[model samples]
Target: MSKTMKISESLIEIAKPYAEAQHRSVPKQIEHWARLGKAAEENPELSIVFIQNSILALAEEKAGMATPYSFGE
Candidate 1:
């Protein structure tokens, strides 16, 4: 099956910078975002746990349990 849809130029402009930084085209960037969104929608608990873990990670940093970013071999 196949379908056609319309997308706005303004939206493309908004996504251009991110796509360029990631070495991808605008359409690929949009498709990647769409896939992530679909997965999040299908698994509500996954999104909730992701948010919770992010908050906990920040708290750990504030408490000095985590080290600052350092590159090593």
Candidate 2:
């Protein structure tokens, strides 16, 4: 369950128009941006392309085309 918190008016103002343009709900658009921000912070050396490709790879795995990794001698 997610808790509702007060958001900054300026932030909501920024997100609302973009959310509408992207056909996403306001909260969902904020969530998407939050995910990107968190990922960038966690992986400073990674490019946006790399992060996007990783998301695609996870989707493929969930659809059953997984390539599990193993390191062995």
Please give the CA lDDT of all the candidate structures. Answer: 0.77, 0.87
Compared with the true structure, what per-residue lDDT tens digits does model 2 show for residues 1-73?
A: 9898998989999999999998999998898788878888899999987886787688899999997788892
Query: What local lDDT score does residue 47 receive in model 2, on the 0 to 100 scale?
Result: 92
* Overall local distance difference test of candidate 2: 0.87
Worst 10 residues of 2 by lDDT: 48-57
lDDT of 1 by residue, 1-73 (tens): 8576677899899889989997889987887667667767877778755754665687799998997687894
In model 2, what is the error at residue 33, expressed in angstroms?
0.7
Which candidate number has the best TM-score?
A: 2
What lDDT score goes with residue 34 in model 2?
Answer: 88
CA-only RMSD, every prediction: 10.7, 4.4
Per-model TM-score, in order, reads 0.56, 0.69
